[model samples]
Target: MDADLLKTFLAVIRQGSFVGAAEQVGRTQSAVSQQIQRLEGLVGGPLLVRTSRAIRLTVAGERFVEYAQRLVDLADEAKRAVHGLAVQRTLRVGIVEDLAGFALAEILRRLHDEAPSLQLEIHSASTRELLPLLGFRYDVVIGMKPLASRGGVELSRLSLCWLGEWQGGPVPLALHPDGCGMRQAAIQALDAAGIDWRAAIVADGILPNIAIVRAGLAVTVLADALCPADLPRSQGLPALQPLSLRLFAHEEADRQATETLGRIISETLGAAVC
Candidate 1:
């Protein structure tokens, strides 16, 4: 019945765990668990089955999800209408540098065409640096899902490919600095395959690494979507696991605006991968 409780319930569902939901809602895990318990009590049944691996909705919870979302949306709409709050005019978006190429251009073009009056601010960084700023500094963030964590709506799962030509002897690699999920995957795969590699260039963002690859100085790991057509995918290398692209919207962000951006991003990236 309470909109806040419903919102928290949705956060848990979206985030896939109480800990992730707490991070998304800016609450402690204990508080999130308590809120879920209160919501379950109000609904007169258990809503979730929690396990160490995942959180699954009960049949009652599955049936209630749509109504809960509707109630929360109506509540937000009612508050805005009653209070005469101005529609949100600015959207701050953060994206990983890897996706800042054609994918970003298409996404921005669509967003502007649909919401012409809305102002936009964009930041490009590595996934490691973008996630932390999701709620506090940006209204929405598009980044790679961390290997160990679960949260955010998935936009696409892209196969990781080795880009650029591979010359002989001690494989040269241009990688993003420490914290990058792709870099970690590349290193682990190489080590596991017993291949010798040298970090020819260590950069903070994707552009420099891309440049290195372009110059044929080193090979880099990137999503298949972001790999340049001219830069060939290496024939012999350890296959890396697919990386998931995810969208994170701040819990307190303007619902309409965030949803619009999220939809455009999903459609744009989803189509690109397909």
Candidate 2:
């Protein structure tokens, strides 16, 4: 009857195994198993029948799951009733591709540890895509502050800086795929300085960009605090001015996921770079 027990059981059912349930709940497998055992003891019945590779819900357990899910959901609803969280379920979040490395890892880790219920649909795109989506498509998104959104949104300031590979070779440049905000910015800086640049000979998601810098392929922009320390970097011909990234954060009415996601992002990213 304990709400936490039912929550644990439900997590196990959703994930199909203790290991997955543990990861989902941010607990060890043994800890998850103990919770199930406690639930069985409380209910005076076994909830699962286990074989070598499979664990099936017992008849009573199967019947119990429906009510358990409802009960846990009701508890969540009750929490929302008095103190509601973000309302969106399938929260589509947009992140700049460059932040995916150091910035995003901290964000996701904190989110996983804190907000376990928010099923995040994270999309990486350039500022071009994320800006409009924040206004119309996604529930809550992260992006650069759009010029036109001034009246409608608020922003958190972040410092962005340009970096380059230090190798004696041609100015190696790392860029997000076409249509990315960082790519446009880097191009602008290069054009202004009249420094010829080349595409990222190696490119991929946020993490790969960091790897590229470490590998001496090219330089990419990142939050000043979050820049990788191991890379051989230079400011190049004329020093590229540091950029202050204004993270546009929107709170949506449809999804409660935002509160949790925000919590995770704040905890993880807030401390990571600095």
Which predicted model would earn the best TM-score? 1
lDDT value for candidate 2?
0.66
Model 1, 42: alpha-carbon shift in Å? 59
Q: Which ranges in model 1 have alpha carbons more than 4 Å from their true place? A: 1-85, 271-274
All predictions: root-mean-square deviation over Cα? 22.5, 15.5
Tens digit per residue, CA lDDT, model 1, 149-247 = 598887777778898888667789998788778888899999999999999999887788888898888999988887667887777899887777888
Give me the displacement of residue 250 in model 2, in angstroms: 7.4
lDDT of each: 0.85, 0.66
Q: What's the lDDT for candidate 1?
A: 0.85
TM per candidate: 0.64, 0.49
Q: Model 1 residue 71 lDDT?
A: 98
Q: Backbone clashes in each candidate structure, one number apiece?
A: 0, 9
The candidate scoring highest on lDDT is 1
- Taking all chains together, the TM-score of candidate 2 against the true structure is 0.49
lDDT of candidate 2 over 94-140, digit per residue (tens): 77655564577767767766666556777776566676777466666
